[model samples]
Target: MHMADALISPAVAGTMYVCSAAAAGYSIKKVRMDTDTKKIPVMGIMGAFVFAAQMINFTIPGTGSSGHLCGGMLLSALLGPCAGFLTMIGVLLIQCLLFADGGLLALGCNVWNMAFYGCFIGALLIWRPMMKHSMTKKRIIISSILGCVLTLQLGAFSVSLETLASGITELPFLAFVATMQPIHLAIGLVEGCITAAVLVFVYEARPELLYAGEQANTRQNVFSFKKTLAILAITAAAIGGILSLFASSHPDGLEWSIEQLTGATELSASGGIYRMADTIQQATSILPDYAFSNSDSVFGTTFSGIFGGIVVIVLCVLVCRLFKFFSRKKSS
Candidate 1:
C-alpha cells in the first residue's frame, strides 16, 4: 500500500525517510560486498518485471479492494535480501518520481512498508528457513505463501501505526487496523499464490539460480538463468501492455480501508510542505496514476505500463552498476 502525503506529518515522514535511507545504504554495502556479477542482470530484469506486475491490480472478491504484486518477496527469493532491497528501491523511485503513483514525501514510508518487510523479515525469517533444507515444489509454495502473508500483515500494521503517529485523527487506530488488516490479508493471499507459481516455474526451469550462492561454481544451469529471465521479461511485457487494462477499478486495500473508516477515499492535507511535495510531483510525473496526464485512453495506459517498465529496468541497472563500481574501487 502506497501512503499519500496526507497520511503522514512532516516529522513522521522525515524520520521514516532517514530510517529508510539508512537501510538502503546498508543494503548497498551488503550487495557491494557480494561479488556475484550474475545477480546484477537478474536484479535489473526482475525489477522491471515487478514494475509491470504492479500495474495490474487484481480485484479481491467480495472486498471491493484491488491489490497488485508488491514484488519484494519475489525479488528477495531470487536475488537475496540485499540485492532485492536495492532493486525495490529502484521500483519505488520510478513510481514516485516518474509515475506519481506514490507521494514524494511518503516515498521513504512506502519503501519501508512495502520493501523492507518483504526483503528482510519475510525472506530471511520465513522463506530462507523454509527452503534451507530442501528446495522442493511443496516447500517453495509453502514458503512463498507464508512469507507473502506475513510481510503484508506487517506492512499493513506499519501503515496504520505511521498514520496514527502523523496525527491523522480522521482514521481511528482500532477501526483503521481492523479494516486494513483484513483487506490486506485477502490481498496477501492472492499475492502468495502468484508468487508461488512464479517461483515454482523458476525452480523447475532453473533451480540453479535459486541456489547459485550456495553452489558458486556450478555450470550446469548457466543457460537456464538466461532462459528464465527471457521468459520473465516477456511475461512482464504482456502483463503491463495488456493485462493492466483489465485491472479492477475499485480502490486498493489502503484506500478501501480509509473509505470504510472515514467514508472518503482521499484525505485532505494543507500545509506549505504538502503543497511543495504536490508541486514537485506534478512537475516530475509524466504519467500520473499509471495513465497519461492528458488522456485516460487504453493506449495511454498501455504506454505508461511499458514505458514505466523500461525506465525501471534502466534505473535498476544503473544502481547495480554504481554499486559495483564503488565496490571495485574500494577493493582496488
Candidate 2:
C-alpha cells in the first residue's frame, strides 16, 4: 500500500526519509567491506525483475482490488538480508522516480515498511536458521512461504501505524489496524505461495546457483554477476511478464478490504502530506512504469528496455568495482 504524500506530515516524511537513507547507506557500506563481487549482477538484475513483476496488478478472485508481487523477501532469501535490503532500495527508487508507483515523500515509509522488514526481519530471521539445515524441497518451500507471509503481515501493520501516527484518516487506530491486517493476511498468503514457487524452482533448477550465489555474494556479508543476471532476465520475461498476462482480474485483497471498510475503492487523503505525495507520484509515472505503452512507439519500447538493461549492467559493475577498491584499501 503506497502512502500518498497527502497521508503524511512533512515532519514524518522527512524523518522517515532520513532513517531509510541511513539504512541504505549502512547496507552499502557493509557490502563494500564484505568484498563479494558475485552479488552485484544478481542484485541489479533481481531489482529489475522485481520492477517487472510489480507491473501487472492481479485481482484476487472474488475481490475487486488488485495486488502485485513485492519481491523483497524472495530476494532476501537468495541474496541475504543486506544485499536484499540494498537492492530493494534500488527497486523502490526506480518505481518512485520512474514508475510513479509511490509518492516521493511517502517513498521512505514504503521502503521501510515493505523492503527493510522483508530483507532484515523476515528473510534473515527465517533464512539463517533454516538454510543451515538439510533444507529439503518441502522445508525450503514451506519456510520461504512463511517468511514471505510474515514480512507482508509486518509491513501491513507498519502502514497502519504510520498512517495513524500521521493523523491522516479519521479511522481509529484499532479500526485501521483491524481493517488493514486481515486483508493483508489474504494478500500475504498469495505472496507466500508465489514466493514458494520461485524458491522451489530455483532450488530444483540451480541448487548450486544458490550456493554459488551466496558464496559469490560478498555483501551476505552477498555478490553475483552475469549468470545471475541471465536468470533474472529469464525469470522476469517468463514468469513475471508472459505469465502475468493471465493473472486474475478481480480486486486485490487490499482494495477489496478498503472498499468494505471505507465504503470506497480508495480512501482519498485530504491532509497536506497526501497532496504532496500525489503530486510527486503524478510527476514520476509519466510513461510506462515497466513495459512500453501506447505512449511509447515500438522503437521507444525496444530502446527503453535496452537502455534499462545497459543501465542495470553498468550499475552492477560499478558497485562491484567500488567494493573491490574498498577491499584493496582495507587489506593494504
Candidate 3:
C-alpha cells in the first residue's frame, strides 16, 4: 500500500525515511560484496516486469476495491533478497518521482512496507526454508503463496501502525486495521497465485537462475538464458503497453481504506515539508497519475506503463553495474 503524505506527520515521515535509507544502505553493501554477474540482467528485467505488472489493478470481488501484484516475493524469489530489495527500490522510486503513483514524503514508508518485508522475510524466512532441500513445483507454489500472504499481512499491519503513530488521520486504529487486513488478505492471495505462475515458468525454463537451483539440475532446458529473457521482456512490454488499458478503475487497497474511514480517498495536509514534497513531486512527475497532464487520451496509460518499465530496467541495470564497479575497485 502506498501511503500519501497526508497520512503521516513530518516526524513520522522522517523516521521512516531514516529506517528505509538504512535498509537501502545495508542492501547496497550486500550487493557490492556479491560477485554474481548472472543476477545483474535478471535483476533489471525482473524489475521491469514487476513495474509493468503493478500497473494493472485487479478487482477484488464484492469489496469495491482493487489490488495489484506487489512483486516483492517474486523479485526476492528470483533475485536473492539483496538484489531483490534494490530492484524493488528502483521500481518504487520511478513510480513515485516519475509517475506520481505514490507521494514523495511517504516513499520511505512505501519502500519499507513493500520491499523490506518481501525481500527479507518472505525470501529468507519463508521461501528459502521451505525449499532449502529441493526445488519442486509444489514447493514453489506453496512457498510463493505463503510468503506473499504473510508478508502482505505484515505490510498492511505496518500501515495501520504508522498511521496511528502519526495521528494525522481521524481513522480509528482498530477499525482501520480490521478493514485493511482482510482486504489485503484477498489481494495477497491473488498476488501469490500470480507469483507462483511466474516462478514456475522460470523454474521450468532456467532453474539455475533461481536461488537454490544451483544445487539442483543445471542441464539444458527448453529455453536458453537469452530466450527466457526475450520472452519475459516481451511479456512485460505486452502487459505494460496493452494489458494495462484493461486495469480496474476501482481505488486500490490503501485509498479504499482511507475512503472508508474519512469518506474521502485522501486527507489534506498543510506543512512546510508537505508543501515542498508535493511541489517537487509535481515538477518531477512527467506523467502524473500515469497519464498526460490535462488529457484523457488513455494512451497516456500505455505510454506510462511502457516508459516506466524501460526506465526501471535502465535504472536497475545501472545501479548493479555501479555497485560491481566499486566492488571490483575495492577488491583490486
TM-scores for every predicted model: 0.95, 0.81, 0.97
Clashes (backbone N, CA, C under 3 Å), per candidate, total 0, 24, 0
- Taking every candidate in turn, the Cα RMSD to the unseen true structure, in Å, is 2.2, 4.7, 1.7
Clashes of 1: 0
lDDT of 2 by residue, 1-332 (tens): 66556556677788889988888888777776665555666677776676656654666555566677777888887777777787777777766766565668888998998798888887667766676655556767777678877888888888777777877666567876787777777777777787778766666555544522442223221223344457667766554435555555555555555567667655665656566666666665544444455554444434444444445445655666765522533465
Models sorted by TM-score, best on top: 3, 1, 2
Using TM-score as the measure, name the better of candidate 2 and candidate 3.
Answer: 3
Model 1: worst 10 consecutive residues (lDDT sum)? 211-220
Sort by lDDT, best first: 3, 1, 2
lDDT of each: 0.86, 0.66, 0.90
Question: Best lDDT goes to which candidate?
Answer: 3
Whole-model alpha-carbon lDDT for candidate 3: 0.90
Spell out the clash pairs found in candidate 1. Answer: none
lDDT tens digits, residues 1-332, model 1? 99999999999999999999999999987777776677877887888889988988898988888998998899999988878898899999999998888889999999999999999998899888877665677888898899999999999999999999999557899999999999999899999999999888778677766732243223245346678889988898888899989988999999999999878888889999999999999999888888877786889889987898888888877877765723443355
Cα error, candidate 3, residue 306 (Å): 0.7
